[model samples]
Target: MALQVGLVGLPNVGKSTLFNAVSQAGAEAANFPFCTIDPNVGVVAVPDERLTRLAELAASKKVVPTAIEFVDIAGLVAGASKGEGLGNQFLAHIREVDAICNVVRCFDDDDIVHVSGSVDPARDVEIITTELVLADLATVEKRLDRANRTARTGDKDAIRERDVIEALRDHLGDGRVARTFPGELPPAVARELSLLTAKPVLYAANVAEDDLGQGGEARGNPYVEVVRKLAEEEGAEVVVISAQVESELAELAGDERQEYLDDLGLDRSGLERLIDRAYQLLGLLTYFTAGPQEARAWTVPSGSTAPRAAREIHTDFERGFIKAEVIAYDDYDRLGSEAAARDAGRLRIEGKEYVVADGDVIHFRFNV
Candidate 1:
C-alpha cells in the first residue's frame, strides 16, 4: 500500500488549496467554510531528481516515479469528537492515514472566512488537537472498560492491557497523545485502538507569500510560533508554504513558473518541499528498476527487507525468493553500464536479509 497522509485542519485553512497545488487534482477551493464535504484522495508522484536523471541517462522510453497518497479530509471542528460538522466520519478517515499534514492558517485574508471568526492559528491548532485527544481518550476508555472486564476473570494478558490502557488514559487526559505514553505498544493493542494522535504529523504553516522564506521568524504570524514550538517539543517537522501562491504558481507555464519562483528567491516549488517532507516523515525510500523495456521507481519503507520489497513488485517474486543484483545509482551512472559496473565490482548480489537503500538500482532473480 502507498504511504497515506491526511491533510487536516480547521475549515478555510487552505487544506484543499494545498491539496490542489500539490496533487494537481482540482479539488474545490472556495471562500466558504466546509466546502470540502467529502475527502479528496489523490496519488502524487514523489519528485526525485535522481530518478529523473537516471531515466534520462538510461534512455528508457517509460519513466515511472514512486507515489504517495494524500487524503484531504473535511475540516475538523471544535466539537468534532461529539459529532459536530462531519465529525466522527472525518476522524474515521484520519484513522486510516499513515501520517498527517496539519495545515494551519497562518495567512490573513479578509475575503476568506475564518471558522473561528478570527485568524488565530494557535487557538485553531489547540481546537483540532483537543478534538483528536478527546476522540483518543474515548477510545482508550472503551478499551480500558473491556480490559477491566477481562481482568476480573484473571486474564494475565487482559490485565497487562488494562495497565497499558490506564497509562494511556492518564496521558490523554492531560491533553497529550497516547503515542507519547513512552513505550512500544503491542501491535494487537495498536491495531484494535487506532489512536488519531499516534500518527506522525508535519505542520504545514500556510503563510503569506512574503513570509515564505522567513522560516517562521517573521513577526505577526502567531501560528508559525505555535507550530514551531509544537514541532520542537515533538521533534516533528514543520514547513512553510503559501497555498494561494502555490496554487497560482501551479497554473503557470514552465519558464514562467521558474521566473516567478526566481523572483520570489526560491529555487523550487513549495509543493515539492511539502511532498519531500511527507516522504521523510513516512521513512520511505525509493529504488529503481531500470531496463530498455521500462524504468520505474518503487517506494518502500526504509528498513524493508529484500523479500518484502520484492512483494511490492509481485507476490510471485517474493514467494520464489532469490538474491537481488544491486548497484547504487551513483555508481551505475559513473560507470555508464551494468557490465562496466560488474567488472569494476560496484554491483553486489544481496540476500533476503539485505535492507534496501534509497537510490539503489536493483534486478531481482526469482522463480515462479
Candidate 2:
C-alpha cells in the first residue's frame, strides 16, 4: 500500500527538521527506498519487529518492509486561500496526499523565532484550519455553480447534486470542514472535489527534548496539552515528538542509537510513533511473507480479503485465484519455521474470502 502523509505547518514549526530525519532514515533503509519521490518527499520503511524475527527464522538473505511516504508541503501563512506566501501551492500539495500531519510548535526558545512571535497551539491550529476550510469553500462554490447550471435542464440527478452542493456550501460557509459535515457526500462528487479538509489529519506536538516523556508519564509541557485537547475536539490523533531528538537519533546506529533511546527512557523514536499513528489514521495493517530469499512486510487496508491482499504482492496472484497458506505470528514463533508449523498443524489453508490479518505470515498458492 502507498501511505502518503503530508507535513504542513507555518514556518519555524520544525517541519523541515522532521523531514530531514525521515529522509535520512529512508536513505539508510535500502538502496531502492523512495527517499526522494520529489524534492520534498521521503519514504521510510514501516518499523516492524516481526519482519526481523521472520527473517531470522527463515535465514533470509534480505528483509524488506512496507514503506510510507512523507511529503513536506510549503509553509502556510494567512491568506493561503488567496495564494499569499505560495498558499495555493501548499494547499495543492496537501490535496495530493493521503493524510495530513500538522506539525505544531509547542517548544519555546529565544533562538528559534516563532512566526506569530509566541507559541499558541490554538491560534496556530485555527490559522491552518481556516485556510483549508476557505480553500474547500472555494471548491464547493465552483462545483455548485456547475451543478446549478445542469439542474436547469430539469435532470433529477443534476437537481440532487445541486442540492447537495448547496448544502456543502453552507456548511463550509459556517467555517466547518468537510470531514465534520453531517452525513456523507455522494462518492463520485466527493472524489471529484477531493476537498482538502476531508482528508484525515493528526497533530504532531513538536516539543523541546526535555519536555518529551521519557518512558511513562508526560514531562508536563502545557503546550502539548493544548494540542492534545484540540486534537481531541477534532477527533484526530496526537503524537508528541521532539524534532531535536529525532534529528540526533537519525545520525546514530546500532548500540549507539539504542543507548540514546535508553538514556532518554524511550523505547523508540518519535518518527516511529508518528508512522504507526499515521497507519492507524488510514486504517492500515501489515502482513508478512518469508522465505530463504527474503522476509518482507506488506500493508493492506484493514478488512481486506485474502485475494485482495495477494494483489499487493502481484496482480497475477489474485488472477490465479487460489487458496492461501496462513500462519499467525504467535504460531510461527512457537513452531519456529514453516515446515515446523505445517507439521504441528499451526498453518491453515484459507480461501479467497479469508480476511488477511495483521502479523499473518502468508504464502499464496497461485497458478499464474
TM-score for all predictions? Answer: 0.95, 0.95
Residue-by-residue lDDT tens digits, candidate 1, 1-368: 58889999999999999999878888898887678888899888877887777776677888888888889998999999989997998998999999988999987789888999998877887898899999999998988888889889888887887887888888899999765778556799899898999998998889888887633234566768878887888888988888977888978977999888888877777778887888898888889888776789998889999888888899998999789999999998898877789999999999999999999999999997
Best-matching candidate per lDDT: 2
Which residue pairs overlap in candidate 2's backbone? Answer: none
Q: Against the hidden true structure, what lDDT does model 1 obtain?
A: 0.86
Q: Compute the lDDT of residue 173 as modeled in candidate 1.
A: 95
Which parts of model 2 are misplaced by more than 4 Å? 25-39, 216-219
Report the Cα lDDT for residue 90, model 2. Answer: 76
Residues 1-368 of candidate 2: C-alpha lDDT, one tens digit per residue: 79899988877888777888876633221112122223388888888988999999999999998999988876687798998876887788788899999999898788777777789989999999999999999999999999999999999988988988899999999999899888668899999999999999999998888887676225588888888889999899999888888889999999999999999889988989999899899999999999999999999999999999999999999999689999999899888999999999999999989998899999999997
Prediction RMSDs, each to the true structure: 1.8, 4.2
Number of colliding residue pairs in each model: 0, 0
